[model samples]
Target: MKDLLIRSATEADFNAMWDIFHTHVAEGETYAFEPGISREEGYDYWFAPRASTFVAVQTLAPHDRRGRERVLGMCKLQPNQVGRGAHVANASYMVSPYAQGVGIGHMLGEHSIGEARRLGYLAMQFNYVVSTNEVAIHLWKRLGFAIVGTLPKAYRHRRLGYVDAYVMYRLLDDPARWPLPEPAPEEDD
Candidate 1:
């Protein structure tokens, strides 16, 4: 297997990023975004308006692979909002279908948390996570994120009607002082 790397994105990465993003969004199972959103719009969403975006690439030795390395995954991070909410960070992630099951999403998620801490964010918040995305939900939960809130029947899922949406949060207090918060207890009806 080749070594994976995460780095800040540049203009050269937009096309590959679009391909990766479109592949996932077209499935309509995870992200709430429209399938037919234009490239220009996606560009603005990922790179232009966001604080930063990153691409994950697999590196090869001089004669290790058939061709040059290529991007396999990407992540976009930005402030949840301006003013009072500036201390919180938000991000979106996408991994190429070819790269799934290889832990690319996990790697990207971990890297984003580190980057968010380095950028001085008090906490990382995911505003609208579709509960049907069990892989992501499980991963985030294991990574110490709490499902702070659940909007019951908030998502209009294609197969499952009125699925819940979640607000997942992880507080990255300080690298030296990892303040692990206790998990919120599950409630029973």
Candidate 2:
């Protein structure tokens, strides 16, 4: 992980990125994209005009393909809406299954937040986070996002039938001011 490099992605990096993207979507567990999304559709969705794409690469890999680094994870930042809603940011991330639990997801998340703030976003929002994806929910919460809304039975989980999805939000300008949860009551023993 010491050799990891995160930077804005170029078209040359798409080949490696596609692998991670396809695998995660194919699993149908975390993201909402169709499992069989074609490469072209993926390209448009990922690199839309308003989106800024970033990738984490294993810089020390010797088998670089066509001068492209091996992408371990990817994130794209964009406006949550258009015109009147453009001040809010939206982002999505994916990490290689082989690289999970090594802090790749955390790094991508933090980077995206900084990038979003740098771009002048008032806040960031995740529109549809699968409730069953506990790891993602925990990570988002740890990163200062709060579950602002829950859409019951919004996501049709592959194995869990119909599951809920969460809408998480984080205010970038002064995260420290965000409200905290009330602590549970303590009982005298």
Candidate 3:
């Protein structure tokens, strides 16, 4: 495990954040964005004015005086719908390929839940989770999200052809009663 720092993203972090976003979009296996999505489009989607975005960084070392760090992951939380349905939050997450499987995604998931609560959201919903993305599906389920609905052949995966997508939901306003797994210990590499 490595030392992970999760913080609200600043304007200065857009370049690195866009790199991760573009990488995932280009992969075309999970996210639904166009493979050749432009930086401006990526910025508009991930850094929406009303959305709260965050970044996860891995610090160089405890004793490093320069405070050097590497961006490993990022996420955005915002209203799933406007006006009437604003109580439910929507979110998207991306972990850099270099940091995949290192628990950075899990950290971002947990941090986003807390942030959503702090922002007064009653629940959180993921609109288009690619069904083939088993890792993310399992992670969201473990975090208390349920597959509320599925759209058959909703995603045109670059390699896998058409695939189903899931709409996952979780009531964050009352986690105490939710059947969520015990939170994992923070990673410390």
lDDT of each: 0.85, 0.89, 0.90
TM-score for each model: 0.85, 0.87, 0.89
lDDT per residue, candidate 2, 52-127, as tens digits?
A: 9999998665566554457899999999999867879999999999899999999999999999989988799999
lDDT-sorted candidate list, best first: 3, 2, 1
Q: Please estimate how well model 1 matches the true structure, expressed as its whole-model Cα lDDT.
A: 0.85
How would you encode candidate 1's per-residue C-alpha lDDT over 1-189 as one tens digit per residue?
367789998888788888988888888778887899999888888885657789898765546766356789998889998977777899899999998888888899999999998987888999999999999999889878999999898887867778999999988885467545569899999
Query: How many Å off is the CA of 21 in candidate 3?
Result: 1.2
Pairs clashing in candidate 3? 1-188, 1-189, 2-188, 2-189
- Candidate with top TM-score is 3
State the lDDT at 57 in candidate 1.
86
By the lDDT metric, which is better: model 1 or model 2? 2
Query: Can you write out model 3's per-residue Cα lDDT over 36-95, one digit (the tens) per residue?
Result: 788888888878999999999888776898887778899999999998688789999999
Error of 2 at 97 (Å): 0.5
Worst lDDT run of 10 residues, candidate 2, spans: 60-69
By TM-score, rank the candidates, best first.
3, 2, 1
